[model samples]
Structure formats: structure tokens, C-alpha cells
Target chain A: MNNLVEIVNLTKKYGSNVAVNNLTVSLPKGKIIGLLGPNGSGKTTLIKMLNGLLTPTEGTIMIDGNYVGPATKSKVAYLPDRTYLTMNQTIREILDYFQDFYADFSRERAEEMLKSLGIDPSVKMRTLSKGTKEKVQLILVMSRDASLYILDEPIAGVDPAARDYILRTIINNYNPEATVLISTHLIEDVEQVLDEVIFMRYGQLVLYTSVDNIREEKGKSVDAYFREVFAC
Target chain B: MLGKLMKYEWKNTWKAGMLMLLGIFIVTVAGCIVLQMPGGVVSNLVDGNEANAAQTWLVISSFTATLILYVIMLLASTWGMLIFLGIRFYRSMYTDEGYLSHTLPVTANQLFLSKVLVSGVWYLFIMIGIGISIVALLVSLMMGLMDISELSGVLTQYNGNVWEFLGDGIYELNRVYEEQMGMNLLHYGITLLLTYVAGPFITMITLFGALTIGQLSSKHKGLIGILAYAGLTILSSIIGSTVQSVFMFSTNIVSSAGGTGITTNWAYDINVLTSALVAAIMYGVSYYIMNRKLNLD
Candidate 1:
């Protein structure tokens, strides 16, 4: 598998504190990679840097052989932890926005998902429940047949049912050649779907291996291994 | 992509823009209607007549109310246009929506330019709308103050050659400007108009630059942005005054020479050139910050 993302000595600092400290990592295509970390471990920062929302204080990030920029943005589909959609916009208008901006955006797929979820296209974002809004955002993000999908805590605040649906939607919609990087602290919930797991601790990559290897080598699930590795 | 960005920008802002314009229109029309009301105008000749006191009082009260409403609407429209544009730019580019905005497949320059262009267009539109409304109100007021027959008598002098009459008036005005300022009034007028149009762009871009600078802070970004705005405003003011004085001094020398003709009209020319340069600098700073140092939280 070709490298979909490459980061070299990436360091993001706030004042005297480092958020992502001299971290180097790479993600290859055709995989569901879990970017697992506890709270304040820089998972969101790394995802934001990949999407070009935050500039790295030092070092560089390359996405698909190009520097993080508009070109990379075109290929990378990002779901920030916050609700980035405008509250004033209708679901259909938001869909149109995605269609207009992303060349790979699939309106048909988005409409099908909305139909399955029983979401009205004309409803404004403010009228939707928090769970529904997350579902809509996830639908829009997944609707794009992007080269890389970067999801930041997609199931953090949602109920278990919604989490299951989100994970299912993510697994069902992604292209085989594309890579999915999901960042979350809920190790057990997403452990079943992850092919490879990268554990981050205090802005550092502590472990990078397949879930099968962790289970085979330690005779424990990835979640249990995570508990042992990152135990305070 | 810039075009598409501008299209979306216009879509986002047009609702509020149109509402402001509509507010101005409604206020102006109401003013006009009030002026045309029976006994709405004050008459100097009828002022001291005891029998007409009630009528005069009613007319004076009507005029006062209409004037107050018109003034409020005027202030609202002007400030509303600018404030609404600023809010749109800040919310769309700096708030949580910024996650989507900055992640779009568009360059920083493209985003900045699209915003500037859309803002400029809206400013111009609102200005034109306000101007038309003011003119209509004035016409209505004139109709209320003067007799229609007398007004028609004055209009008969134009004899359906209003354009030629206006041209002659303009030529005379140009001759006067040529004598006093060594420049054509038409050229000076164009420069003044350009200066006016450049104002909103400079203001908007400066705010953008300030917001970008503010984003560098982890907390109280809005406060930082406000401070940056205050600092930039003062800096620009000092720079503008210096440039103006320098141009005024040099242009005095040319004015004394009396040889450069239209080109020597340094007053409006300096204003236009200096304004364009300032706006360009603001745009440059905004583009740099947006491209290199964007730190949306």
C-alpha cells in the first residue's frame, strides 16, 4: 500500500507547551487505522494539522505526495469534532455545498443515506437534534469518495446506537483504495473495526501495530493492551 | 473556485444585505408619504394665524416624527451594511464554521479575494440604494413645499434638453475647477468616487488581518483581534496623514507651476492613490496571515 499521509518531526506548540512534540508517523492507503489516545494526547491536533486548520509550529506534513494545501484538501475529507455546518443552512443546501466544493462528493449516496436515516433535506441544522446533526455531518463526510478520510472523535458524544451506526456507515462507505484515520479515546467501541492501531501518548507515537499482532503477541485484546501500555 | 466561493459568499450574505436595503427603502417611502400628507409642510406665511395653530402643530409634529425615523434608518442602513458584512466574515472564517471554510479546496488568496469582492459589491449596492432613497425623499419634500405649477414652470426652462443643460452646467463646473485647482471636475469626481469605494475594502481587509493576528492567541482571540484593529487603525491614520501632507506640499508646487493641467489635480489623485495603496497593503497582510499563520481554534 502506498503512503497516503506522511509526517516528519511534526511539532505543534502553544506558547512554551508542545501539543504535538517532534512526532513522525505515516499512514498507508487501503486501511482502517485507529489513532488512539487518551484526553489531551494530540489526536485532534494531528488531525487538524492534516486538514490544514492549524499550522504546525515546526516540521512538515505531506498528504498524497503533496504538502498540506488546497490540493491535499481536495483529496482529504475531514470531520472536525465540532459542528462545523452553519445552523442557518438547510440539509439540501449543505449537500449542495459539498457537491460544489468536492469533485468526488456523491450526492446520490448522500441522499440515500439521508433517506435511510429518515432525515428531511429541507430541515435547517438548528432544528436537528445533536445526534441527528452528527449523523448528518458524518453522512456528508462519508459521502465523499475521497482518497483519505480523517475523522476526529466521530463517536465521542453520541449514544451507543448512533456510534454503531456511524461506525457502520464509515465501514460501508469508504473506498478500498482509500485510508480512514479515526481518532478517539473509546478504544473498545472501535477496536473491532480497526485493522491497524497507532497508540499516542503525550504527543508521541508509543506503538504502531496491527490489532491481530497485539492480540497474538500479548494474548489480550487491543483495549486491554492499551490499558496496560498507557496505565497511569 | 474563486468564482464559486464568491457565489456562495453572496448567497450567504444577500439575505441580510437585501433586508438592510429593504429597510432603507421602506423608511424612505414612509418619509415620502409623510411629506405628501395633507398639511404636512410648515408654511411661514400661516405661522401666526390663530385659526391654523392646530394644523400647523400637526404638520410640525409629522415632520419631526418623519425626520427622526429617517435619520435612524439612515444610520442603521449605513452601519448595518458594514456591521453585517464584518460579522459574516468573522463568523464564516474565524468561528467554528471556519473548520469547513478553511478546509475547502480553495487557496487562501482565493478566499480572501472572494470575500473582499463580495463585500465591496454589497457596500456599493447599499450606497446606491441609500442615495436613491435620499433623492426620492428630497423630491417628495420639494413637491410638498412648492406648487406643482411653479415647479413645472421651472422645468419648462429645460425644454426636454435636460442632458444638454446638465452638460453645459458640467462644463462650467469643470472650467471653475480648472481655474482654481488646475484639474477637470470630471476626473476629480471619478477619483473621489474611487476613494469612497476603496474605503470599505480597506476597512474589511484590515479587520481580516486583525482577526488573523488574533487567532495566534490561545484565549481571548476576539479581544486580541479588537486590539489589533485599534492598532492598525491608528497606524493607517498616521500613515494616511503623512502621505496626504507630503502630496499636498508637492502638489502645491505643481499648482504654482500651472503647467501640468489635469494631472496636477493632486488632491483627489493623492486621495485615490494613497487609499488604493493602503487597501492593497491590508490585503497583503491578510493574505499572508491567512496563508501562512492561520490558527483557527
Candidate 2:
């Protein structure tokens, strides 16, 4: 299988606290992989490392074929869990910013998505509600034609209605040739859309398998299997 | 990419500097207008024609009040540029804004350079504005103190030829230069001008470095960043002071047994050199932290 991301002995620590343990995983291209882990399971830490936000204490992460840097960042579109755009900027300015920075960014696609949601590009980010801001962020991320899409908790705090809208946007705009890594612990809501699921517990990888494999061998839905495996 | 980054940085940061520039211009203009007013109440009171002494007191008191206000704002805005730029760096690099900044397809050096250049430009503008304001205020004060007709008479005393007056000033300066051969006026002027022009950029580097160091902490980053700035500034001052002491001793500005003997203002040169050195060290620290030790919360 052609892997889009290759991690080797990845480990991240904060002083004496270990965030990502000494384990490695390879995520394949052209699939929606769910990085399922509860709070503090090193999901965000690993995602941050992949996006070059944090440095690893040991090991390395390679995107496509090269080590992570400006080249890899160009191909990797990241949507951080927080609102990263300046609140003082208008949506139009942000669109211009993305278009300038990312070659893979499509202004037409982003405009279309914004139009469908009835979001005015001239409006400032400060005027928008939190849910609307998240939607705008998701639209920007999904609009990119990148090699890897890393979404950290994209649907964690939104209502079920907004969550469905988010899932639809992801599904509708997902580039078939690209890899999507959605990191969230809310497994049931995202299980149906995931092609593969990787369960993480206490910074250690518990399992990595296809969603169909979990159904066939465990004789249960991925959500039910997740509950059984991660029951606390 | 650096140009684009600088363009956006300037776009975002222009408002603060613009507000300050406008404030200085407006206040200076108001003061000049007041000074130029016809038949002012203060003049009446001063000439022993206190027909409306109460009105004169009110007018003078109000002008004093507003003068105080302008002075406070002027001082704040002049010195506030460094602090404001430091805060800007903190917000863009350490807060939620950092997530987008670090993930962009540009290198860390490009980002740092963009911010420093944009900030340096604003500092230059604000410094020029303050300088213009001070010169205007001084001219206004001179006009208020001296009778305008007499001042014009004095101006035409040199046959209205500005160059002739400038030549006389240069002749006096030449006499002084002859008496003090060690003081090269032209060279000293160039050095002074260079220091004035480069001061803002060097100051910006130190602040950016402190802010980058502050990013290492997981909590209370603002407080840590401020502490870092204070620490760095103190260390820089110590270095500058130590170099200045050495220069004074070697040049005999301070003679043996601590007997005071001073000539040129060599301390200023030592301070400028030390500041440039500190800025270089700070830039290196910031670059390393941005690339390797970058741990954003």
C-alpha cells in the first residue's frame, strides 16, 4: 500500500511527561483514516508534530517522500482545533491570504462552499458566531487539493446538525487521491465515514485496521467495538 | 513570500502607527494655531492690561491642561512602539494565531524577517513624526516668546540671504573645530545619524527574541514573555555599561584615582555597538527557538 505518511519511532515529550510514545504507524493514501483516541491520548500532539507545529523528542515524520518542512507543508493542509485566523480580518481577506500562500487552494471552490452556506465573504471573522467560524475554517481546509488533510477535532464541540453539515462538506469536497486524517474521540458520529480506524490509548497504539475488518471479525459495529475496547 | 508576508503584516499593523502620527500632527498644529492667535488673553495679562484677568486665568489654565494631556500621549506613543510590536509578535506567534502562522508553507526565518521589517518601518515613521512634532513645538515657542516683527527684522539683518547666515554658522563651527582637533564634527555627525537610523531595528530584534523565548512556556506565556524582555534588556544594558566603562578608562575620560576628566561622548558609541551585538545574539536565539524548540500550546 502506498503510504502518504510514514512515521518512524515517533516520540514527543513535555519535560518528564510523555505525550506520544515510541511507536510508529503508516497511513495509506486515498483513504479516510480516523485517529480515534480519548482526551490526552497523544492524538493532538501527534497531529501537531505531523503539521510541524511541535518538534519531536525523537524519530521523524515524512510526508509523501520527503521530511516535513516548507515543501511538505505546501502539500499538507492542516485545520487546527482552534480558530487560527485573525478576528480582525474579513472572510474575503482570509480567502485572499490562503490563495496567496497555498498553491493547492482553490478560491472558486471556497467561494462556492461559502455561497452554499449563505456566508458572506465581506463579513469580518469577529462578527461570526463560533459555529459559523468553525464552518468557515472547515470550508477553507476542505477546499484545498492537498496530499494530506489533517483535521484535529473538527466536530468535537458543534451540535449534531452542524456536525452533519461538517461531515457532508468533508465528504463532498474530499479529494479522492488525497489522504484524510480526522482525529477525534467521538467515534460513533465519525465511524460511518471512516475507511480505517486507529485506536490510541495513553500515547500507545492499541489497534489499526479497516472498519470492515472490525465489523467482520469482531461481529460488531466499529462504534460498539470502540466502546468495548475503550470502556472506562 | 517574504514580501507577501510583510505586506500583510503592514496592513494589520498600520492603524496603531497612523493613529499616533495623526495625534502628534493634530496636537502640534493646535499648539501652533494657539500661539499664532491674534490679541491673546495671556499677552493682555502680561502687559499689565488685565482687563479680563478671570478669563485670562481660564484660558491659560485650559491650555496648560491640554498641553499636559498632549505631552503624556506623545511620550506614551513614542515609547509604546516597542512594547506594541512585542505584543503583536506574541499574539501572532504564541496565541491561537500561531497555529496558522507555523503551518504556513513559509520558513520560520521568512516569518520573523517579515515582522521585523514591518515593525522597523512603523518605528521609523513614528520616530520621524515625533521629531517633527518637537521641532514644530520649539518653533512655536520661539515665535510666542519673540515679537514676530522683531524676528523678521533679525532675519532680514542678514540681507534675507539664508546661505549667508548658514555660512557664518559654518565659519563659527570651523573655529570650534580648529580649537578641538580631536573632535571630527563631520564624522561624529555621520555616526550619530547612523545610530539614530538603526536604533529602531536593533531594538525590534531584542523584543522578537524575547517573545520567541517566551513561546517555550506552556502557561502564562505573556507574563513569561514580559519577564524575558525585562531580563534581556537588563543584560544588554549591563553589557553596554561595562563596555562604556572600559572605553572611558582606556580613553582617559575618567582619569587615574577616579579623578573626573571627560572629553567626547564615547559612551554613546559603546552603547550603540553593544546594542547591535545584543540584537545579533537575540536574532540567533530566536532563529534556533523558532526552528527547533518551537512548542506552541
Docking class of 1: high
- Local accuracy of candidate 1 as per-residue lDDT tens digits, B126-148: 88887899899888877776677
- Give per-model TM-scores: 0.92, 0.91
Q: Candidate 2 residues A130-206, lDDT tens each? A: 99999999999998999999999999889999999999999889899999999987788998899999999888899
**Per-residue CA lDDT of candidate 1, range A1-232, in tens?**
3798899999998888788999998899999999998888988888988999888999999999999999999999999999999999999999999999999999999999999999999999999999999999999999999999999999989999999999999999998899999998888999999999999878888889999999999999989998998889
DockQ value of candidate 2? 0.86
DockQ values per model: 0.88, 0.86
Candidate 1's TM-score reads 0.92
Candidate 2 lDDT over residue span B1-297, tens digit each: 999999899988999889888888888888766654455554565566655767776667756866886788688887787778888888998889999999899998999999998998888888888788878877875665557788568679898888888888877885685355334465557668877788888878888888888878888878887898889889989988898777756656434455443334566577888888988998999999989988888
Interface RMSD of each: 0.5, 0.6
Query: What TM-score would chain A of each candidate receive against the reference chain A?
Result: 0.98, 0.98
- What TM-score would chain B receive for each of the candidates shown? 0.83, 0.83
